[model samples]
Target: MSLASLSEAIEQDPVVTRELLHEVARRSGFTVAPRHEAAYLLGLRSSYAIAKQVDLLPDYVDPRLSIVPTLGGSRKYSKPEPDRNGLSAWCHFLNLQAVKTETRLLENRSIALKDTIAVGYIPQTLGTLPHFISSKTEYPHSQIDATVVRRLLLAGATLKGTSICENFSLSPMSYTSIFGPVHNPWQRGFNSGGSSSGSAALVALRAARKAGIKGLDDLGPDVELAIGGDQAGSIRVPAAYCGITA
Candidate 1:
């Protein structure tokens, strides 16, 4: 009896055709099988099921998310190769520095009030700037007055200006201490979009709304909250996917 008949008699089930091709390929070390033919046979049912599933699935109809903060005459934070040293300082320092520079520029009127609210991993030389936001279980430095903590506090204060209402709050986000994947509000399994992951999550989940945006004057200390930009599609992609519009 043929091998096929013998197997049918023993198992009482038909074998996948691709398995036979795979076995031939393995023994011959190479075979003249048709390109993607095996895949076509194996995935035929799954492909049809997927097509029907897509037909049944609902269509996505929503306005695309936009880049907020309006960093006029400036490029958004799209880093190609960010500095290594920048990471250790908890990226917050860079953010603080950028805002400070912008404040200084504003004082000089070098850039218009409506200039783009620059934020990136590495601070730009002139047109753009960078910032960081970090959250940790235990303070890295023993003394709170240490450089890192001091910088964070200083940046916070600097971002918070004279007006009481203008002052924005900076909150802790993802840290290694927390453990597990960052909580992406849109899709729980995915990243929340950190190191400012929590901040973006808040906006995405509508846990906290934009509240209001008047202009540069209205911008608060929480720069991270004001705009979302991470190297790996942190802001734009999630904002687009989640249908966040603000």
Candidate 2:
């Protein structure tokens, strides 16, 4: 390309061009002839060019929706009221299972997903306040179910809902969610534990239920298992704190 064209491209992608050029300069301190400088530099722009439409997601995502897409979720699934969610363990509530599933191994078992996993038409709070508090114009939600979510539903597991997680699933502590802290089932006000704190908390509470343990009866509906997004000590730490396996 001409020098004028190269200059124009760098202007359009100033940040990327500058960073890449800086790195190149730092690594290769050797000097080059001025006549070949423009040609040498032109190659670097390939990484940032907008060559074509970038929508690469699957054209057709199978319907792993909230029973009905338009209505957030079916009547059977819903957001838990404040009183019902005293433990602050759930992001939302639902009873999703494949109607004509091939397997029934997990039948009657209730599971919760960490809010980070995608569940079509359900609000993906990520335990942060986007539309949940500030922006009513749009509520952050997903339009397709993650692979594991689909598999679980197909396996006849009754999905209880998405559980609240550390904000953006980053922190290794339970108190980071925007809504509130997830209380320990064994003792309220105590730590429930990490990024997957809600998931572990719910499952631990449910485990305690069958063992004849008491004190966590009304926190929310019981969950037998949870699909957590573990990055750091999200899963294991919470499990350790709650005296259960993740």
Candidate 3:
């Protein structure tokens, strides 16, 4: 590629450029001497040129290609809105309008998903940093859905919302998240076990409704099922704490 083209690409993505520069400087213990600055820019230009040429190599492959077929139907996804509940169990609230399917196994079943799973037009925080959230114009919409989400849609599940999780699914206590602490359903002061805390809480709330308990949240819907990740005791611990079967 021409140097001008390379510069344009870098300029278009200042966020990526900043990160790349920081990483390179950190790893190399770079210092900005006047002579060295000129040499550094020249090296970066050369590297960009080489990378541009490498893109033409036949062996290279696009990493974002997916093997799964797209789900067909006139499905509608709502824009993400905030949760009013102090439970802090949700990251984004989206109601997906259901499409009629010949096979309706999970028809009318309200489901919530962990935020780590991608949903088109929904902000995916993964219960962590804001920087992880995609820019509004990054793409037309989410290009692909997570495999589990796709399967749920195919099975005629209504995706009610995306639930919160511990930041990067690292915490067991659910306290160290960017969304703030997730509280236990049974008690306000107690912690909801994580990282599947939100999923467990949603399920527990639905279960409570079935037991004739009322007025949990005016805005909250009855979540029949929740898709959560289980590395270590993420799913099991929260499920146990919330008195729900995982």
Candidate 4:
């Protein structure tokens, strides 16, 4: 749509207009004196007009190609449950129900994804600094799976859920995220090294369950595999800290 059309739509919302004006004034250091109010409004309008035009620009992609071509068929999944411990291991537990396919290589295996990786229809945060469950202004769900995720599904891995990660997958420790720190699986107050902290924790939990450890009954079934991203020591650190094989 044109700038004028967008501006007209915006002007219809009196509350929005007032809020925008207040924000503009605050950000401008309140330098817009009464004598310059008209000029300030005009400038704000022009800026908004330009922003609207920019927003309308189409995002072009080659229609002839796909990032990862789908396999002959799609695999089904079961709904995933959140971690019981305050490990903050998961961002969102997905609900996908599917029967196992016997012919696939990874048939019956369950997998948890790091939040940095995209999963179709699930929400991804990559551990945003100031995290919110959803964004009002953006598309609500991921439209496609990451290539790794798609490959896993094709090989018959069941996507159980998405795990938490360091903010933007940059931190070496898990403490600096909106979901809070991922605790060491063995020690409650100890740090779980990031940004693959959750993945390691989940694996450790699964191992604990397999070992018939008491007091870990709430951790659900054993996860056969976990997918995590690494830069520096994200994957290895957490794995060592949690006493699990990465």
Candidate 5:
């Protein structure tokens, strides 16, 4: 039944409401205080508790089950490597984005000791770099790429502000200067688009399936977009290189 209808029914029956809250608490993995009454207000509280509880599962365990594409990258080749190494790098970045986003979300709720996995090197690199979580991450012993991503994502969501993911580019020389160059997937002669080179290539090959563009909007039939365009070669460059329309 719809939540509204269920709520009305709950308000009308005290005995039923008490029983229901007891049952819900047991099933929802929460400990209800003895002093807490099983009233409509408590029931409403339980609903959100249930949501947050369930939300933790997918964030921790399931990479495929995502409401949002929390990661991005490209599909071009830079140097010779084994078995499309650049492509793999791209996939790692995408995977970590989702993981990081989830992590951020969880931490914002102050859920203690939530497990986070780093998507790939990015999380690890960032952890080692100057960041807030790194200090709490035990100075290199406790950092997991996937875990860090999940933690970061969870944190990013709770701040009462616009949530946005933007596109930025860096050339081969530039990227390498920042975070070493990635190996190529195809041939050595080909150039994986720089900046998000690895991620773009992965999305094109279906190795990574995530919307590069993300924004909050209240619309029916949720938007499923893979990439966004801003300036020259922001998204369209990857889209065209990958042979995708959007």
Candidate 6:
């Protein structure tokens, strides 16, 4: 294939040292004959680079171009309160309203995102040891909003903040989060389910409050809706445990 004509040199694979190739061959149980090795190494210098269209994508969303703090703008956030967050469902709380450039399809509705879904400036701990073990270099605040978060704000939903989730989203149950286990909103001390644990618990807590149930307390944080991630029963199991639709 023809390569683009350019003033600057096209990229080449300069790091393919003969020693490195020997190491690779040894590890892979393959033998590269010394006679053909030089020619084989020379062949790797070809590039897959292509010419770009001036209008690469007519109106592609370049996340980096968004210089603002977030679509929700700057907003103060609160930590999980012991009394207010008995279920350990939330990672942080905020009163972030949408920027509202489109139709207000989800106006006035509060939505919580799974911690794995990045929200610009909000700490994204993913319910792990990073919650306490952090420094300026290691603190895990998200620099950009996830694609779903951007759409939710454009649709006019208020962004409440990120919710707790299983550590690295590796657990099938809510008991593995570093923030602490997420309790079932219907019955405290019981599991609120899994990797999407926080999302399910928040929604259930809101529903339980509206139902005016006697046993459920009004102490926890609530949201009208929550966005969860699913891999296996991450979302489904949590919904099932809370007796609600996810």
* Count of residue pairs whose backbone atoms collide, per candidate: 10, 0, 0, 2, 42, 0
Best by TM-score: 6
Give model 3's TM-score versus the native structure: 0.64
List residue ranges in candidate 1 displaced over 4 A.
1-138, 141-178, 186-196, 207-224, 227-229
* Weakest ten-residue segment in model 5 by summed lDDT: 216-225
TM-score of candidate 1 versus the correct structure, residues matched by position = 0.22
Q: Taking the tens digit of each residue's C-alpha lDDT, what string does model 1 give over 186-222?
A: 3445543333342344344443234432231211122
Per-residue CA lDDT of model 4 for 215-239, tens digit only, reads 7666544366788887798898888
| Lowest summed lDDT window (length 10), candidate 1 | 160-169
The digit string of per-residue lDDT tens for model 2 on 1-246 reads 555765576557565554566577768995546676666556656444433112433466555533322222352457789888878898889877776666898888899999988877677778887864346654566767788877887778888898989887778878999878998887789998889988988988777777887766667686888988766788988999999975
Least accurate 10 contiguous residues by lDDT in model 4: 63-72
| Candidate 6: clashing residue pairs, number | 0
The per-model lDDT (C-alpha) reads 0.31, 0.76, 0.71, 0.67, 0.35, 0.76
In the range 39-149, model 3's lDDT, one tens digit per residue, is 565566557656766888777323432223324443344433444655778766666643444358988899999877777555677676665654453323454566677
Could you tell me which 10 consecutive residues in candidate 2 have the lowest summed lDDT? Answer: 66-75
TM-score of every prediction relative to native? 0.22, 0.76, 0.64, 0.62, 0.28, 0.78
Candidate 4 regions off by >4 Å?
Answer: 1-86, 95-103, 129-140, 220-222
Candidate 2: segments with Cα more than 4 A from true spot: 1-36, 50-76, 131-137
TM-score order of candidates, top first: 6, 2, 3, 4, 5, 1
The lDDT, on a scale of 0 to 1, for candidate 4 is 0.67
lDDT of 6 at 193: 88
Instruction: Give the least accurate 10-residue stretch of model 3, judged by summed lDDT.
Output: 61-70
69-91: candidate 6 lDDT, tens digit per residue: 43445757788778878788988
Clash count for candidate 2 is: 0
Candidate order by lDDT, highest to lowest? 6, 2, 3, 4, 5, 1
